[model samples]
Target: MSDEGEMTGGEDRPLDWANEPHMSSVDTIMWRGDTDRRMRGTICMLEIYDCSPDWDRLVAAHEWGSRMAPRFRQRVVDSPLGAGTPSWAVDPDFDLHYHLRRIKLGGDGSMRELLVTCEQLAMTALDAARPPWEGTLIEGLPDGKAAYFLKAHHALTDGLGAIIGLAQLHSPTREHNPGKPQPPSPDPVNIGPLDLIGRQIGDEIGRIPHRVDLALKGVRALTNPRKALSSALRYGRSVPRVAGLVSPPGSPLLAHRSLSWRFSAFEVPFTDLKAAATAVNASINDIYLAGLIGGFRIYHEKMGSPVDTIPVAIPISVRRPEDPAGGNRIAVGRLAGPVGIADPFERVLTIREQVRLARHEPAVDIFNTLGSVMAWLPGTMLMQFSGAASQNDLQASNVPGIPWDTYVAGAKVERMFPFGPLPGCAMMATMITHNGTACLGINSDGAAVTDLELFAECLIAGFGEVLALAADDGVEPGVLRRVE
Candidate 1:
């Protein structure tokens, strides 16, 4: 599951984006949940470039990218009754000036300053009235370096979906190519919540036959009552785990919640992470989670408040090959992080087994299965599920990155760090292996991770312990270095 997704499209064909007129139930939950700032589902990507892209060309690229993927120009319209998944209508008055921005770095021209600026940019809530996304081309870094921060609502796309969009948006060469396809802008729409109600009702009615078919299938299952009962019992038992209702107890050390966020960035050679994974005979994600828990272990010991285990959540991709590219098709997998294990290999092995079991849950697809119905719930009732993520100390995601070098305008992208939204978790970490480097973007809840400096050091050391497994191969475990 940690294997990266390859670039599978060419310029001749349009991107296989999610072009559905309405948001999926899960997307609806994220879009509406923004009412509670803590539940903001904004995902961001930060790219460090060799130099600032030609401003005129960069602007043209965004205009081109927006045209290639119409969702960028579309905004959500909630159902008039505030029930059911919302509709996506193209903005008749779409303005590129509003969403695209440029700024000069104010502090010392360092990665720390850049990421801190990004932290503030990320923490500020997106405007719900317009498209829930923004882009800033940050100039004035050292060595003529520049960074671009693009923030989007999780409802717009998941990690993988974002990758698909990025892959299309970026170029493989420094030189401009005239062969790139030029897509026409999308047609404007004049629709709102009132206009969506009738369509929503019809869509609900369209599912009546499927519900009846399911009922009929259940009736038929009665002929094999024993088997049906066993299956039902197994599914019933799996529901709690899949829903995260029966997960590891929350660690008191991470009990605090906050309105503010802190950011840290880290990276290492992809080979180092791969070597550790191979040494332990575990998936990359297994090693990734182990390293994170290992850091928590060191942090707890250093802080003098040790915890045995903590609630962790991972997004398991349920996206099938046939599914469209620009929407979430993920199931949440729960883990009881192995903080008590002192050995990194042991922690990795424990996580491998936990992930194995989590992946096989009978109700692993419960989110998507119930999303359609849940999206119709009233605001208060729908929000009750938001607390599930709050119980997690960490939420981690690993996305396979583009293996080849890519360029934006004429600026080469050195590395791309992905930051997932906190969503009440103490921390959210996302790693994307870009051009042989694994760039990690970490966001910590300000109240929970009070000592971010010590936290960063503990993280590097924690990963160092795992990378030590490659000692037999003569690899320097120090290859697991922090970027900022």
Candidate 2:
């Protein structure tokens, strides 16, 4: 099925174009295929649910979907006609017909089987494109269940922004609502050569002196015993408070990933995770990683290969509310997690402490700042090298969701699972809590983590164990322990 319609192009703006190394860094390391042209990140997945068999309602979803393409599509007007160092920004030119795809899974396959097929298909879509985004609605799974799969370039929107964009198309109430007020779609401002190049000049000039000073200070600190001692003390004292900024630990030896991908999901009630955290006085994020650790530990043990500590990466958003409107404002933090711990509670507590140390470490912020300087390298080289580097074992993130219930074409959104990239890593696990439900999306590499289903099961079971512990004692005592 397809919805064909004309899409009005948004106003054109001259984009600021320059070959900044860091800007290229995102392009090189993140992009997966032959051409850098596909820099827009893709968030693709298969959603399974039971829809009423009414023909009219099914038709309406396709019809309503047409009006939505222009809202979410992004266009880059200034991309180099030939493959080159940089591609400038522009508003996406969305085509409803081109973006939305529909196919009926044969009656022979179950919903689970259909989902597996979709995961393999998503992996095949490694190439990039302009105005980058695509969607497919797979209906007619076994037992009256259907699925919706969507992929949008990472450069276009982050997890939170994507949710907001999707919410625009949904009806506010259960009843069919018409003439719904459309959101204020911001106009694209073209950043041309003069604007982009001029700004780059100023930024570069300003950073020169600071860079020199830091370089000198770094050299002096290395040679000066007194200064080095003071810095070490500072690092130790600050580790606990900013531990949230670092990565969780994982084993260095991980399963080998193939070119193909596999997707899996499991449900853990928000109440269960919250209750478990309460039992241990940990935050939702802490509990979340604990579940991941439990899953990882089990995965390793089952394979007869386990490690005491493993390195994990956590993305820390540097985009403050008041920062300028465009470009990437995120940094990566590396932290170690103790997945080898046998006791679930002990592992949770250990992770909580490790995270605390990472959040408070001054080096976390310093490293991010340092990365900006390294961003001066060319995009192609960065991509070539980093792409070859070992992929992180898992990418785990929790994004905040809508406060109230939301509906899409009258289908009550019972759950929202966010599927992120599994690039170079074993898998990417993203969690979003909609209303009262915690929807977990796991995207695993086919070769490395073959048993994603089992991994997800462990996450579900680990949280259950933690909640049981919490039921016995209130969270206050655990909170008090950290305070003291």
Candidate 3:
């Protein structure tokens, strides 16, 4: 969103990130839940470029970006006792040198080796004291190519918001634009833990009227007791499904969870994936889940630990066109993945129906509805209280990408991969279609996926099955390739 109170199609504007001083109840949980090391909420993005952007220009771009979007210069200050939501305050000790880093690969400098470095970087937790984000420029690839890695807390902004934030900072063309507007740095605000607690108190006090209004609604509904009772029962039945209190059959093989993380990359043509989805009369999301679930089926069969179904989790975006493009605006949706289904078309069909039902749950918005009350709970107990995603084997998300070409400093971005956090899940798979390719970044628990080689092969073959469906539509066969 622009500072002028409206969003321009593609013009420069202040981002709608961290605009508010206090964190929302939902973001508070995400930030505090880091108490459980296994449920780190770090999200990362890796972008490959045709060539290394000029170092001087790159630094200048970030400096300008920090001023335009002050959230980059802010840090999370929790309430005194972690009893409530935190506040976003400008860091008094902000230092660009600490957050921005540059490194060069030493080995053959293959994409595979680069990913290994990324995995190590991702495994290192960000300092909660400082602004919960960092960036690195990795040079020395096979050609003149380079890559950039950006990691931030999930409380900062979601995958979609990150792209929006990126679009504002990245240049539309390779050549430097001397006439770009410069925005002043946001004034520093001294916000401490005690102040945050008071802010939380004020927010809670502010919600009394809403609560009272809801209570009055209930009282009025009692006049039509039968209708009210039916609505209450329907919502009550859906609460478990939305909260993940109900778990589906699990795969014994992917049951383990650990602190160690490993990374794998894959890409498929967007056109082909969409075409295949259309061929099956399903949405792209269904096809994506089917391919992922199909891969699990192949992997389990190969590992001699076949299962009929496994619990799958996907984020159901609750973001609206009028909502601010910041933080998370999503709810969890669970599915009983049909791994037993041998046919790709059948798997897609089954997944499509399951997704439809999950979205239509009477209480699909339960989390957001009760986040205020839940946020009051101490951080230490949030893992158990929040019904952690640990019960699921896979957590996947699909985010719309920046459709046009973009450059940072002077280098044009080639492929953009997003690695989502593994909040107790065996794997977090995120797909973002950059340009025409759907770049899939999978962050797996090191112990859960013992055989990375086999896992990658199975995923490729699984996607191959789904992509074949497009052949009947006169679409060229799309090939899913493992990125190094």
Task: Estimate TM-scores for all models.
Answer: 0.96, 0.73, 0.96
Model 1 Cα displacement at 126 (Å)? 1.3
Worst 10 residues of 1 by lDDT: 1-10
- Model 2 spans > 4 angstroms off: 1-41, 45-71, 77-94, 107-109, 142-145, 182-253, 323-328, 363-376, 388-390, 453-457, 474-484
Error in Å for residue 456 of model 2: 4.4
lDDT of 1 by residue, 315-417 (tens): 9999898988887888888888999899887888899999999899899988898888988888666666776545689999999988888888789899899
Residue-wise C-alpha lDDT for candidate 3, range 257-308, written one tens digit per residue: 8888898899998998999988879898998999999899999999999999
Q: Which ranges of candidate 3 are over 4 A from the true structure?
A: 1-13, 387-389
Q: Residue 271: error of model 3 in Å? A: 0.6
How far off is residue 29 in model 2, in Å?
Answer: 6.1
Judging by TM-score, tell me the better candidate of 2 and 3. 3
Superposed Cα RMSD, model 2: 7.8
In terms of lDDT, model 1 sits at 0.84
For all candidates in order, the CA lDDT equals: 0.84, 0.56, 0.85
lDDT of 1 at 151: 94
